[model samples]
Target: MELLLGQSETQVEYDRAGTIIKGQEVILPKRKHEDVHVNNHTSVWGLWWKDHQWAYKCCQQTIRNTYCTGSAGIEAAEAALDFIMKTY
Candidate 1:
């Protein structure tokens, strides 16, 4: 299964009930390993929205040791992604 959601070019879609239909919601989109640009730093690991809060998942690299919520999730993910891109 695809662990990541969202795309930079695509608009997120919701259901008739006003809820995001499963994996359609954008948390952090899947990104490839690239050394040239900072924006393209993320790898297969991703952040997601769960239980009305933000959570992160690590695959080849770890982003956080514990749970992250709200803006912290985004911040942690960005830092981790940059680190992974540089170090891994």
Candidate 2:
């Protein structure tokens, strides 16, 4: 989708939407160990819920903005995508 949209030569990492979860940490969509979403369909994406907020990670980077969400996982991915896509 990004390629079709001319969103640069984005690397479509091989991963599914099961990288976000408690007691697990996924890095760069490779599941380095384990971790955090839903229908993320993103290459580099991970999410964690903490302190009433969601921790969004992408492209080997993590940002919370202290971004918060009523739900974790997918919602976190959504929030992270919003920020990462816009800022970077």
Candidate 3:
């Protein structure tokens, strides 16, 4: 699925307040445990925004690993997670 970045050329519509009026729906898939890694280190994390607040969810890795918050929002976080899952 194509992830929407809200670019000017995108087919998305925005209101005066810069909110998403209409566009493609975003669906972030769940990753299998063996499919996720961060820079060769096992990591599992999640990010979301609600009511102007940011929430993060993460699980500890039992091995030599690290959990890092290198993403901003839900989309970026999910995209990064997906890339890592697919790449490593």
Candidate 4:
């Protein structure tokens, strides 16, 4: 399924397991607003919940491109939820 952030033009794609498969395209303005300042470097960010996690390795040219991974027997679900909510 696809989820769109309220009026932010950010879109997130999830699989049947509720893991984020894709996030919206990142632009310079939005990146700056989010305080993600990366120059000539790649940033890797991930989200995790009880037994679930997703990560995105982003660069200046590609933000939608992500790498996903999963965890097991873990409980920090709230952190993953918050990361997803605020990042998008």
Candidates' C-alpha lDDT? 0.48, 0.47, 0.52, 0.44
Error of 2 at 62 (Å): 18
12-76, model 4: which lDDT tens digit per residue? Answer: 99899988778954446534433552342234444222234443333212223333222321224
lDDT of 1 at 52: 56
Q: What's the TM-score of each model vs. the native?
A: 0.24, 0.20, 0.24, 0.21
For model 2, residues 1-87, the per-residue Cα lDDT tens digits are: 767787665344434775544443455656553343323423323454556644444322245233333345557667887999999
Q: Candidate 2: which stretches are off by over 4 Å?
A: 1-71
Candidate that beats the other on lDDT, 1 or 3, i.e. the better one = 3
lDDT of 3: 0.52
Q: For candidate 1, what is the total of clashing residue pairs?
A: 0
lDDT of 3 by residue, 1-88 (tens): 2455543565888889988878966778897764676643323433434455443333222223444433343467577779999998
In the range 41-81, model 1's lDDT, one tens digit per residue, is 23222454445543343222234334334355567767987
Instruction: Give the clash total for candidate 4.
Output: 0
Native-to-model Cα distance after best TM-score fit, residue 65 in candidate 4, in Å:
38
Ranking 3 against 4 by TM-score, winner: 3
